[model samples]
Target: MNKKYQVFISSTYDDLKEEREQVIKAVLEMGHIPVGMEMFSAGDEEQWKLIARQIEQTDYYVIIVGHRYGSETEDGISYTEKEYDYASSLGVPTLGFVISDDASWPSSRIDKSDKKLKKLEAFKSKVKSKLVHFWESKDDLHGKVSISLMKTMNLNPRIGWVRATDAPTTEATQELVRLSAENSTLRKKIEGFKTIEQPDEEKRLVHILDDNTRKFKVRRKSDKGRWDDAEKVRNTLLEIFLMIAPTLVNESSSKTIAKEIAFEHVGNNWFRTWPIGDNKIKGMIADLVALDLVQPSKKKHSVNDKEEYWSLTKLGNSILKRARRIQLEEGIDTLEDKSEEDF
Candidate 1:
């Protein structure tokens, strides 16, 4: 899923303006939203409330520590420190960047007040308590920010925003909830019964896939070095579905599905191999949808990407589990015989 995360940037406004710009640029380049105190007037109770709310909504918190301690709140806490503390309290994933001790800096940007300098040192110490990067230059900071955020995001994913158009509709949401409840009931019932009769829906779907007349066509390189139609192959829908079902456990693009299908069905031993043609792939996907075996993925992706993403429906997963799970019986031959009879 291509999710756009919101990053809340915290730092002193004036001294680290250039650094802040770099961080914002990095965030934007990574296709995420960047928010900071630059948007609002500071040092007021109302403004702090608004800042707190914004921090709460943000997915990640990034703090840039420099020479200055920044202006303080009424409680003697610097605004930057307050933002960091609030974000930490809420358990937001934080990325801290502290200026290296050896960094060359102008005397004008350094903290002039003794009290503020002491607070600044304490704040830096607190920031260093966690995993952080030391940077001496804006460019250095930008690179580190991008790399760190990527790693953090991968290690710990967050619920991010999606376009309104891509979000599931009200009716779809309601249907999902209904189906979830039905699935739960069915599972409970299955647990209570040793051998439950197959539902008519499942039987019908299985029949559609099991039909021997259904065939998939492919093209292969000819002896003349041109593409030509290969002999039509007959693979039961159940077989094809089973081959590609695991990849669909997560939302996967059509390209990923094609690769999975090709790798499994089309042998690599062939001089040149091609995945199932797009049209045939689409037809197969549509068949699964008709059987309620798969559905369109609602996860967001980049706007530039045009590939269709798919995920297994509840029924699809249930069917897959039943088909692939090993039997409890210790008699392997007996279990194999029973499986063949059931199929």
Candidate 2:
């Protein structure tokens, strides 16, 4: 809905004519209405009531306090301060603009009267307690008003004025109210669901990797001699992941262990080396993550920023201990669906 908010601009007029004009321009440009005192009135019940009624109707109450302290009441408080008090009491969304300490102005604009200066200082202090913005010059005030008003309106939206014809009918209003309550209820239910812990990563990983290890069998090169070659080992990326995942401790050790596992399992012997390719290792790691077996840590080594690390999850740890105990239990290539790890 295209609604215009009425913002009551409360400030002394004569000393801040330029300031008020800038504020009015800022408010008007943003499509909101600005209300301010055009004529000075005496401190009386009728005048104050009129001002209070205006503040009550406004969506926002803004004040720009300069050096001059305007006419005061019998209680010695400025009329501007009285207006601020009324606005504050009504709980209006108020924005205050105070002149900086180093701001330069004409002698006429400056409050030379010691009593009025003290009251102005007190008023400034009161405004500072709320949402107060600082300004040094007219140009600075213009920019500040524009930015501050934009931000304030976004954060604290008000019940703005609209044409009576544009307003919703009572029946439509009732429907809207019903929908609003239902929406709130649905939001609370969604929030309750958010509190529930997500599915276990470990269990999912173990399921994908269950009994999936590659089988390997070693044979003696000579009839009466010890085994010499790992040539019989299954050459698969899953085998590499199985080899290094269990031994991993922290970030620094995972890569070192991965390379070592690749070299030992893939290379087979000390003399003839067949090093595992980095690309192959990387691809297997990616699959492991997709399976949720291992998660890459977000933390980086202080000395080596580019260093990457991964750790096995809870189920990964259990799976690590179980090794290739697939399902069946006894054979050299065993554990093939013989236990809970089969899942």
Candidate maximizing TM-score: 1
TM-score of each candidate structure, all chains considered together? 0.53, 0.51
List pairs with backbone clashes in candidate 1: none
Candidate 2 local lDDT, 128-153, one digit each (tens) = 88757667898779766775676567
Candidate 1, residues 88-196: lDDT per residue as tens digits?
9999999999997778999999999899889999999999888777788998798678767865775577998998888889998999999999999999987888576
Error of 1 at 114 (Å): 2.0
lDDT of 2 at 173: 98
Candidate 1 structure lDDT: 0.77
RMSD of each: 15.6, 24.5
Assess each prediction's global lDDT (C-alpha) against the native.
0.77, 0.67
* Candidate 1 wrongly placed segments (more than 4 Å): 174-343
By summed lDDT, which 10 consecutive residues of candidate 1 come out lowest?
326-335
